[model samples]
Target: MRYWLYKSEPATWSWDQQKEKGAAGEEWTGVRNYQARNFMREMSVGDRGFFYHSNEGKEIVGIVEVVKEAHPDSTADDAKWECVDIKAVMDVPKPVSLEQVKAEPKLKDMVLVNNSRLSVQPVTEAEFAYVCELAGVDPEKAMKG
Candidate 1:
């Protein structure tokens, strides 16, 4: 399965809130950037993603699974953008901070290192595994509120 990273502003939608939404998940909307929209369109069911808490925490706080494929964003008037449904899979015991990721030698070549501005980006299997290791949790564990 492919891996990816998706950032969310904590004040707007925190990890806790998403977990409360349960397995039904929520539409990944409001992605205005062309690059982010492209990534959304590429996502598929069962793909995993890093649930990043931007702004407040600025860290990779959890893991998510794409429950549905890309569809035209409902919030949009046109079909130019897309979104997917993602369920919370895991929560890092101690969030892997942006600073921590940058300091780790293993993550130097990771996309988050080279593209901090990307709201949504792809992640390699190796990088995903390393993050799970740092979080001290099994990558497959389901996250609950």
Candidate 2:
């Protein structure tokens, strides 16, 4: 499965709120950016992503799994907008802060490091794995749930 990252302002949507959604998950709506919307369209059920707290924490606090594929965004009136449903999979034992990511030589090419403005962006397998390692999580075990 592909890896991705989803950023949300903590005051608007925190990691705790996402975990409360349970297995049924919640629609990742309100995205208006065409590039971000397109990234969601490329996602599939079972794909994993980093649940990042933007603005406030500026960190990767947990992991999430795509429970539903791309579908019409319920919060939007435009037919061109779409999103996926994702559920919290596991918490990062040690939150990986943006500063940590930027400092890491191995993660210099990460989208989160280079294009911090994108709310939804793709994550390469290597980048995903390294971040998981940095967060003190076992990538294999975290994905099993």
Candidate 3:
């Protein structure tokens, strides 16, 4: 499966709120950027994503699984965007801050490092594993859990 990084302003949609949704998952809506919407459209069920807290924490706080593929975004007024259902998989043992990510030489090519404004972005499998490692999370275990 593909990997992705999904950002949210914690003030708007925090990791706690996602966990609260549990197995049912929550609609990842309100994405207005065409590039971000396209990324959502490419997602498949079971794909994993890093749940990043953008404004407040500016860190990768947890993991989420795409339980439902892209569908019409109910929060959108027009039919130009789509969303997916994602459930919290697990919390990062040690949240990886943006500062840390920027500092990590291995993450130099990461989209989050190069284009921090992109709300929904793709992550390489190697980058994903590295971030999980830095966060004290076992990548495989986190995915399975």
Q: lDDT of each structure?
A: 0.85, 0.94, 0.94
Candidate 1, residues 1-145, lDDT tens digits: the string is: 7899999999888899889878899888888889988888888888888899887878988889899889988898878888888888767787898899999999998888998888899998888888887878675453221
Candidate 3 regions exceeding 4 Å error are none
Deviating ranges (above 4 Å) for candidate 1? 139-145
TM-score per model over all chains: 0.92, 0.97, 0.97
TM-score of 1: 0.92
Candidate RMSDs in order: 2.7, 1.0, 1.0
What local lDDT does model 1 show for residue 142?
32
Q: How far out, in Å, is residue 116 in model 2?
A: 0.3
lDDT of 2 by residue, 16-114 (tens): 999999999999988999999999999989999999999998999999999999999999989999999999999999999999999999999999999
lDDT of 3: 0.94
Clashes of 3: 0
